[model samples]
Target: MAAIPTSNASLKDALLRPGFTPTSPAATRLSDPIADTPLVLTLDDVLPYDANPRTTQNPKYDEIKESIRQRGLDAPPPVTRRPGEEKYRIRNGGNTRLSILKELYQETGDDRYYRFHCLFRPWDAARGEIIVLTGHLAENDLKGDLKFIERAIAVEKARTLYEAEAGKAVSQRELASRLSADGYPVSQSHISKMLDTIQHLLPAIPGLLYSGLGVDRISKILALRKTASACWDKHYQGEGVEFEMLFQDVLSQFEGDAEEFFFDRFQDELVGQMKKPLALGYEDVLLEITQQQRELRRSMPIVDAPSLPAPPAAAPAPDTSLPDDTAPGDAPPQQPPELPEPPARLAQQTGSQVQLPVTPPAGDQMSDEERQARIDGHVVSPANISPRVVETKRKVAAALGETLPDFNSNALIAIPVQAGSLHPISDLWYIEHDIDTPEHLREHIAQLAFEITQSVNAPGEIIPVDGGIGFSYKQPADEVDITETAHHTLTLLQSLSGATAIALKMLGEQPAPAAMDALGEFQFAAGLGQILLGQPTARDQAPDDSGRLSDGALVKLFRIVRLARRLIDLEIQEYATNTSELNG
Candidate 1:
């Protein structure tokens, strides 16, 4: 509601001419007087602090931009005013808002939208870094809108800024706790993984961060960060391979500019490679190319011989005289020698494995240690793994019966899901608080049992491919894994269907422990059925990998045979109880 001055002189005059109100009795003891009254100025006077550690991308960005354009600012920008400068630097927050405002101003020439209202705070060079860093971190964390990469970047920046301010390195846990105190509740383990993704995986593939990929996409790849790094170290040995070359190679494999699509394809291929019993995966492929390069480098001489050499020349005499061929003012005439052209760069070798292009110019190469440092930063410390990673690993180990040595579980599940292969259980969640009749439930259970039985007997034959056999199931390769356990589970489910049907029939007439026992078996059966349908395959080999149903599907022939059995039991029990009461 308050209007402010447009310039330094008028700002001073306005501050002096203010009708000030005394602070309320409720004011906290720690409250800073300077933070009480926010500063108001034209948006032109507020400059974005380029070093503020936060970023957001769209269509998420587009959403925020549209929201502000329609609804205006919900929170004012936070800025720092210099000692004698007229302008204020937005230390943290409101960057997206500022961008939107500027855009709207340009589009519509609206003056009202051109003004900025912000909290004006004092700045100290050293401490200001911490303040600004923490401010943006808290703001983004509270909004819960930062993509995985953005959060990683912000977290890394916070650690760097804090260490710079305090003059000592802080442990990740300590930093996370500090951030938590400042209003962003985050765990040390999470910070550690985020650091790894931002510091390592992203640097290894520079353009990926900018290619419309989000945090979810980045985090999925970071699951294989260690394996990829090991592969990189094994093949390239030194940081001779440019990240751009690798990114370009990946980009070339897919059509269109939709980065997520490319990423999905890339991760799929990488996963398939990882699944190979003898494959070195992404690294092995890259390493072959490196070997070929070494061969070519060895064949070529370091320095080429001159095409022609000049004849031996005698020393010039002490000369005050000009050459007889030249006049006094004539330009000194000399013929220029033809210089030989440099040899052409080596053409990349053609193969299935991704080939690293010829080594880029010297300036573009990163040193081995520098590249390793980036990766090391993102590697999840075995000493402090996050709960999510731990749980994912546990589930994966149980399901697959093999330990993924350095792999993160979150990535194992996430990559397949993002690729549209595995679906979350939440997708099939239903709210069935009550049911009506036992006979009605029995009919439903019978129908489900018939469908599941038919599927179990249906031929799920495998077709032979170049290397291994691929399944002939109608489902896409992304939907299911062809594990032996899944095959057994389907068979067991078929047998259990008879017991479930009997239980449903018994419940409609009279309730008994036999019916209850049959019903109870439904839970175990359904759980396994879901796992069989939802689980990701060990290898990304075949095209029809996705099973007919998602992990969370209900009332489906392939995915939820057991769920149907359970629902029938629930209705039967309810009917039996009601009938008993009426007889009493």
Candidate 2:
């Protein structure tokens, strides 16, 4: 057996390089002189690509090893050496195959496994490591083997290398373009999600991600974090708790195999924990998350499926009637028979009563166009219009806080002229205020407090309060006539604000509410004032044309409601304990 070359210098000087003058007939007949030349080398002479995108062992490791052990290496992996480097590493991929070769050689001491063929190619320093990294990524992508996290990490590394090459910060679009030019195509949106995963998720749940969590699940996790974080910030009162720390704590419990990691389970636990700091309920957190998901889906581009060709038309039915003027074998083409006109109407007969087609009522038979016309004309009375039209008109009226005249009567719809007993607002959402017992009242008050938070933070046009009253958060394009409901809603909100201020001052003399410090007490009062005053808007300033409270806004409102309920419960418990002590 021939001795193996030990050093880089010895290997380079002794090996028959591809660019060297060809002596064999096969080499001389080659069209390209610089084509890669296959060389037999010991396993130790070559190295696996250190920057391979695949981090885990091949799933088919045993099968591939058995195949190689029986038949030997059928294909030689292309290898290249960087400038000033002695060892040759994989040019594109085959790290797994290389590893299996090493294992086989060790297990059996087989010369065939130890000395295998490798195709050598010269590396170009001008193209740099970006080319090599992308090559591995492309190869792994073709095999469909790399995990989502592995691909994310590899892409991030590519971003760094590209930035270094460019000598400045590179945008995701530019990175995507550069990658596509280099034979590995990744979309800009995909790059953004990958970066988000690396920055936000990898630190918190590395096990879940590394164990094979897919892109779809990772996207969901990131969106949930964003929504939950926003809620935490809104309700948090500089209390020592941090959203990231809380997220990490919650995520740690669910860390394990990615397959076993239930996303819904994790989401529930994370939201449940967020309730305390965010002062929200599970439904509230879920609402925000659901809204985020909707926005994401809406933003994604729609790809239409390819159109299919229509089937051929069926042949017309054959005419069986024979022609009258020709020979038995010869017949003329048949023509379709025209229908005769209708007979005179019965009403046209002398002394007959004039009859007309029976039709349904105009309201019942109204078309969409006619309904829209009625809505445009401010005809929104339920008695005169279809239920759907009435609903549409009500939404518009509630959003604008405008009262319209009854379509048939031409008189304004009845509204409370004075703020007397609390009543339900027609065509708007209202909080129930009538309670027979203190326990029910407490629950009602707690619910009202929760809704107040939603009103302040939620996005849309209608802000419902007590006494058939509502307000619009958005400024109208033109001057809006404030109806009785709008006037009453604002008045009730203002009164509630003033009353809450007085209540907070009185509560300050007693012990702070449970889960609240001095700062929290102040924050709670301030939050209520903001809600009552209609100061807060949804995070996004964009108009909500839907005219209803957004899911996110509802979630935020519920969170405050939950916190308010907890505080109320705590205060009641303290009062009960004090009264019992006095009696004793």
Best by lDDT: 2
lDDT by residue for model 2 (39-132), tens:
7778877899988888887667788788888888887888887766667789888888899888987898988888888888767667758888
lDDT of candidate 1 over 501-550, digit per residue (tens): 55467676765776666567556554464445544444763333233332
Best by TM-score: 2
The models' CA-based lDDT, in order, is 0.49, 0.58
lDDT of 2: 0.58
lDDT of 1: 0.49
